[model samples]
Target: MEDRLNRIESKIALSEDLLEELNLMVFRQQQQIDRLQQQIVDLHRQLASGSPGERRDLREEIPPHY
Candidate 1:
């Protein structure tokens, strides 16, 4: 019947809208994930460069009178 066809069309439209919304949400989430990943990489680089190049050993120190 025509009524059944109309109902089916409406359902299809609604489904398409929902699918588009979900896709947009996924895109936004991926952007946020990329930004966070970049931040982590930047922080790691900062930590690596800020540390001392080498550590000194106490055993290598000579006694005060030696």
Candidate 2:
């Protein structure tokens, strides 16, 4: 009777802790997703700003060697 109640209470506490941890994990993942989405938007804008007919020179991308 009392022992059963204690076990149930213990289980409930563990479940609550697990739920909180899961919620925190979800929140962190959402933040990362939002940042990634913003980065993608920025990249798209950068690409769109370049002239459509222009070709980037490969040599221009090379780092200068001393």
Candidate 3:
């Protein structure tokens, strides 16, 4: 009767706490992913712009014997 009801209430409370913790963890991970994505975009922009000293030529990789 009352004892069974108490047990069920306790289980429901624990489940609610666990759900909140999982949601917070997922939110933090999403923030980290957003930051990493921004870094990738910045790097791509830098590579594409190729400012002076950052220039790279693929034709430089030729063997001396050729």
Q: By summed lDDT, which 10 consecutive residues of candidate 1 come out lowest?
A: 46-55
Please provide, for model 1 over 27-64, each residue's C-alpha lDDT reduced to its tens digit, 9 standing for 90 to 100. Answer: 99999999999999988987789763467798999999
Top candidate by lDDT: 1
Residue runs of model 2 more than 4 Å from their true location after superposition: 51-54, 58-66
lDDT of 3 by residue, 1-66 (tens): 999999999999999999999999999999999999999998888778885255558798787898
Query: Across residues 1-66, which tens digit of lDDT does each residue of candidate 2 receive?
Result: 999999999999999999999999999999999999999998888789984457979877878773
* lDDT on C-alpha atoms for all candidate structures: 0.93, 0.92, 0.91
As for lDDT, the candidate ahead, 2 or 3, is 2
RMSD of 1: 7.2
TM-score of 3: 0.74
**TM of each candidate vs. truth:** 0.73, 0.78, 0.74
Evaluate residue 11 in candidate 2 and report its C-alpha lDDT on the 0 to 100 scale.
100
Reference-based TM-score, model 2 = 0.78
Clashes of each: 0, 0, 0
